[model samples]
Target: MGGLSDRFWNGAAAQLVNAIIAAVNARDFDALERYATADLLFCDSRGGQISGLARVIDWLRDVIAADPSFALQVDAVTSSNGSALVTGTTVSRFFPEARRTLWRLTFSGGRVSEWRRYSADPLPVPPPLTAH
Candidate 1:
């Protein structure tokens, strides 16, 4: 595992990313038990952070259960060096609009060691530049 090449690691990372998204969308976080390390840490864009796989799983469950229409549409995944970065659009009935979130994951011993999600809300476009 540790001796794997960048290509191999990246591929593995991508697979992990997809599996995580699927589980989250299904609201079955228990399926992620194998993917997360015992001491995994998850940090959210809302300044919320949780450590330990069990705690993280609980937190995810609450977030997913909050909105019945909650869904994540993954746009891209980039992986390398034991880490993966995933960007996706989040649609939730609880929110007024769609939001983009970037998920960064680090892997160790073939399980996710840390996960960070950064949420980015869309901003209105500004008017075109004009000479004063």
Candidate 2:
């Protein structure tokens, strides 16, 4: 029974990842909206929060307008306890470099109720430690 449950969740999470990738690549705002709840909440690493589907759509549009070359390269997706954690790289046509980002999608009642994104800067190499 547990094995079946695990497979089921893994499949669902993969499906969700596929849907998101397709929607983003196609720039289909409707599909994105459908996958998310009406009162969806998106929180950025800076602690800024955007609530509601309409606002989220608007924000996404603005981002695309600012960076038309933006695309996602999903490295991995993992699901546990009804939430999916996506690790990926943010690729941009205009930018010369790719940025790393993590997305956490929380699902409820067949819709994503919350989405959190975390971005990071590459760490610098550490200096060699002296022998004691």
lDDT (CA) per prediction: 0.74, 0.76
Kindly report which residue stretches of model 2 are placed more than 4 angstroms away from their true locations once superposed: 93-95, 121-132
How well does each candidate superpose onto the true structure, as a TM-score? Answer: 0.80, 0.84
Model 2 TM: 0.84
lDDT of 2 by residue, 1-132 (tens): 368897899788879877977787678989998898999888776556778878877777766777677777788888888899999887765446888889899998877899887875421211122233
* Candidate 1 per-residue C-alpha lDDT over 36-129 given as tens digits, one digit per residue, 9 for 90 to 100: 8999888665555677888777766666556567777788888877788998887877568788788898999988899887875421211122
Query: Total clashes, candidate 2?
Result: 0
Cα misplacement distance, residue 71 of candidate 2 (Å):
1.0
State the displacement of the C-alpha of residue 85, model 2, in Å, after optimal TM-score superposition.
0.9
Off by over 4 Å in 1: 1-4, 121-132
**Which 10-residue window of candidate 1 scores lowest in summed lDDT?**
122-131
